[model samples]
Target: MNEIVRIDNLSFRYMQGLDNALEKVNLGFEKGAVIGITGPAGAGKSTLLSCINGVIPHYMNGDLQGHVLVNNQEVANLTFGQLAPIVGTVFQDVDFQTVSITVEEEVAFGPENIAIDPAEIENRIIHALESTHITTLRRRAISTLSGGQKQRVAIAAVLSTLPDLLLLDEPTSELDPIGTQEVFEAIFELNKTLGMTVIIVSQKVENLIDCDRIIVLSDGKVAFDGQPRKVFMRSQRLAEVGIAIPEVTAFIIALHKKLGQPISTERLPLSIGEAQTTLENILRQYGVLS
Candidate 1:
């Protein structure tokens, strides 16, 4: 698999402070994989995402060390104008990213700023709107949309530039359940169909249950990096770092301990359907179901 992002001994510290915000972090993300970053509030999750887009040392005053490479180019050496095309960022607050009144113009803003041809910008606007399933709202004012709709517009805006890697900071934080599902579905489609590499920093682990991998951060360092199942099964460690597993996975663990069943934590289920299947199998073995 092609590497989309690579971090080597990356460390950063606020100029006004004495402690490091990120310390000696090392990781690699491949194309077409959905990776999740989770930790406590002060664990530097957002700072890590910002580094991918060159926001740390570029937009903010900070002391930085090590390297963050996107598409094999170091972020520290790239300008926002040069990085915009390859790495698109969706901030936690969608309202902060909006720049146009209508959805169509908002989606076209980035391409326009980059001097893309008018015809090509129009084509990209339509494609992004359709990709995000917000084509019907293209003509609507940005203020009139709900929180979820606003976030969809923000994503469409980024997609208009056709970025190879997407860095999302809690994209579904403010959406309702239905809206959250819509956003996740769109992300899933992009990863599976368009082969877009995604790295999301989120507090809600339930939304990341299907991610290809999960990375847990604590005290500005990587605590765990592995498959979702492995991370979820390490409930004690996750809790220690202020991270939570999917509720269904927690339920399965509780049930297994209470029933004294030979439940393998390695195959822990992340979704309700998988949990149901596991429960049924356990019941059958106990002669409660046949």
Candidate 2:
């Protein structure tokens, strides 16, 4: 896989006297990957994203060590304006990010600032709105939209920039279940259809379960980096770090423990459909089902 982002021996502190927020972190993310970053509060999850998007040294005051490279260009070498072209970041608060009164202007903000051609900007806005399923809300006032609609509008605004890397920080933290699903679906479609490299920093483990890869941060260090099943296998360690395994995977793991029959790691299920199939297969093996 082509490497889209790389962090090498990364460490950072907010001020000279402060303790490191991130400590000796090393990671390489492949292009077009759907990556979930989860950890407890103050675990350096947001700090990591800041590093990726050039917010660490550029906009925020920080003492830094090591390098953050996006598309092989070191983040420190790029100005905030320079980094804006390659990375689009949607912060946790949708309300705070919205400045334009109407959805159309909001979505077009980034592209317009970058001086994209008028025709191209319109095309980008339309494509972004359609991609996020908010075309009908284009003329609506930003304040009139619901949580899900606002989140989608924020994503659409980021999408208008047409960035190669999309970083969202706890996008659904304030959303209801339906809104969460809506935001996630838009993100998944962007990954699947546009092949955009997406890194989402979320506390919601259930939402992270289906990601292509999950990175667990603990005390500013990577505690786990692997498939969802492998990550769940370290449930005890995750809990120690204040991270929870998804409920479905937890239940399946419990069953395997009680049966004294180890379940194949490859067959571990993260979703209901997969769990159902795995359970049915197990029943057949035990002659509980014909």
Candidate 1 per-residue lDDT over residues 42-109, each given as its tens digit: 89898899888988879888888999999899998999989988889999878888989999889999
Clashing pairs in 2: none
| Model 2, position 6: C-alpha lDDT score | 93
TM-score per candidate, chains pooled: 0.94, 0.94
Q: How many residue pairs clash in model 1?
A: 0
Off by over 4 Å in 1: none
Each model's lDDT comes to 0.88, 0.89
Quote the lDDT for 178 in model 1.
81
**TM-score of decoy 1:** 0.94
RMSD of 2: 1.8
